[model samples]
Target: MAKGKLVGKKLILLGERDGIPGPVMEACLKDSGADIVFSVTECFV
Candidate 1:
């Protein structure tokens, strides 16, 4: 298996999911070894 370069990287995640929050995506990023320093999401209803 290959390792990722994000093993100790800082990230700022500003993501949206079809105008909604993407918790799953956020989790995936975190799982990839990124430390979320800031995050923001938007939702439309």
Candidate 2:
């Protein structure tokens, strides 16, 4: 992803268990200059 694309923004990530997890997504976006409100990993099975 482009750096700082989410700069000065707030994020609420909803991730999947089989796909990218919340923490992983959070890590990837950590350098995006965004404030993560929360990250949730949901399981659908």
Candidate 3:
């Protein structure tokens, strides 16, 4: 069996490098019931 970090834990997304600039990805995650503990508009990666 494999234990996951996000299992039953509050989610915290630092950055979502969508290969573009915008809050599209962030919004999508929020709609999907994500906690979104932390986030950034632009990611370094």
Best by TM-score: 2
Note the residue pairs that clash in candidate 3.
Answer: none
lDDT of each model, Cα atoms only?
0.69, 0.91, 0.52
The residue-by-residue lDDT of candidate 3 on 2-45, one tens digit each, is: 24453345555454466643355557655454455665556574
Task: State the weakest 10-residue window (summed lDDT) of model 2.
Answer: 1-10
* TM-score of every candidate: 0.58, 0.83, 0.39
* Of candidates 3 and 2, the better by lDDT: 2
Model 3, stretches more than 4 Å misplaced? Answer: 1-9, 16-18, 41-45
What is candidate 1's lDDT per residue for 1-45, written digit by digit as tens? 325998788887666757535465577787777777887776544
Error of 1 at 43 (Å): 6.4
- Which of 1 and 3 is the better model by TM-score? 1
Winner by TM-score between candidate 2 and candidate 1: 2
Ranking by lDDT: 2, 1, 3
> How well is each residue in 1-45 modelled by candidate 2, as lDDT tens digits?
446568889999999999999999999888888999999999989
Worst 10 residues of 1 by lDDT: 17-26
* Residue 44 Cα positional deviation in candidate 2, in Å, after optimal superposition: 2.1
- Highest lDDT scorer: 2
